[model samples]
Target: MSTKQRIAIVTGANKGVGLAAVRQLALKYPTSPLNTGGSLLIYLAARSPERGEEAVQTLLDDAQLREAGVLVQQGGSVTVKFRELDIGSAESVAALGEFLKKEHESGVDVVINNAGIALKGFDSAIVRETIRTNYHGTLDVCTTLLPLLKPSPQSRLVNVASISGMLDAYSPAIQANFHAAVNKGSIPAVTALMEKFQHSVDADRVEEAGFVKRAYGVSKAGVIAFSKVLAEQQRQDGVVVNACCPGYVATSMTEHMDRPGAITPDEGARTLVMLALQDLDGKRGEFWREEKVVEW
Candidate 1:
């Protein structure tokens, strides 16, 4: 590794916004404000190694064509390593921790928690799976990887949340619990809240609790809360964490929608891409929309 090398990892990066984040991140590192001239050691993680490698190759080809010779050369051959990571699985999350320990002695620099699912149909099975992957899965990844995210300035974690995760979407009581838990730095309370939401789903009474009826939105709300809580816990370590809306993106998740105004995958990835490269400037536990902090 070069003296200016940065280790970055992006989950669910095989396609859509996740893939775009990985691509733009490769370009961002060479010119990142946090580490000017830094070469990116990007882990383009996916649940399937085959898909991840394919995305890596596609980005590599794009870089060569788009920058001619400037990008890879200036960045000292920006490397993309693929890892099979199923964030929904605790065993898989543990495997990622071990892999990082083996790969980078200095530890990770950037993490984009982009691997999440959206369930439009609220089957009992579907809602649990949604919470498992979006809320608990994200929570597990952050907790497991915090120790590996170098305890220094300029380190970042970008959770790809949605505007739908807006706190107001929850009832005032649930919001109070979330804020109090985060303020107190109690991750267990956060976990319990997420489980409570799951139980609401089981009871088919999410609306009664003052939450969005959709499991996808509810799950994302959990992710947003977890981001804030983890940010508080990691603040002293100089690690900046943010939860940001990726915007209404035209991916498989939204392909079924008969609506207009959907942005391309690349456009949707802008907030997340920018978040990974920001200086943070003493900010933590922020919610962002298009790179600007929002009141969510």
Candidate 2:
């Protein structure tokens, strides 16, 4: 890869918003002789390699895209390589880190931590897997990929959070307490609240705690917290780390349920794409909703 070519990795991109983001990136960074440098090198990493390959091939085979030179850029085209990455598995993440280090030697400019689960399949197992993949897994990937991000002059890190994770939406009383903790910079207090809610399942008090959706909300809240912490740590490195709530997007995740004011996959992907391309100049650690920054 050339110095001008920006490399980005979007996890769980086999379908939905993830796939849409890859398509937009390819289109925005097209190949032309007028543009001397390659625009972007994208890794559409998915949990299933076959699905990932198919997604990339589909983009490559698009008739309109081909005619418009959407996927190709400069001397090199937008190569969508498939890599199996199971965020729930630590072993998988470690192996992926090693693979990227060897193959993408120049390192990645952007890391969109987009692989997430809603915990809808199981009872107890669902809750456990949600926290593992959404919170802990994201942290593992960040640490493992830290070296890859260190070299970039314009590095970006985004955590796809949810409005349901907003403390105010939970309960007014709880929000009041959380606001106090936040004002005091008490991260431990925030973490304790999450732990309390997660443990509520054990006592069958999750509903009482305003965790009717339970694990999904808690997991996304963890993402928001993680983004804030990471942004503080990497602010000086020119790494803009932020989180966004892609408001009730209509996708497979919400196919069975009733959704109002639901945006299309492209709408969700656009928010993420903007974050990926945002100029660092101290716009770090912001929590956004659509194009606007929202209060945490």
Using TM-score as the measure, which candidate wins? 1
CA lDDT of every candidate: 0.82, 0.74
lDDT, candidate 2, 99-198, per-residue tens: 9888778777778888888755535667777877887788788778866784443677878888877766676766665665555555566567666666
* Model 1 error, position 51 (Å): 1.1
Query: Candidate 2's C-alpha lDDT?
Result: 0.74
Ten-residue segment with the worst summed lDDT in candidate 2? Answer: 28-37
Write down the TM-score for model 1.
0.93
The lDDT, on a scale of 0 to 1, for candidate 1 is 0.82
Q: For residues 208-269, what per-residue lDDT tens digits would candidate 1 score against the true structure?
A: 97666677777787788888888878878988898999889888888635467778888889
- Over 4 Å off, model 2: 30-36, 73-76, 121-123, 151-153, 171-193, 207-213, 256-258
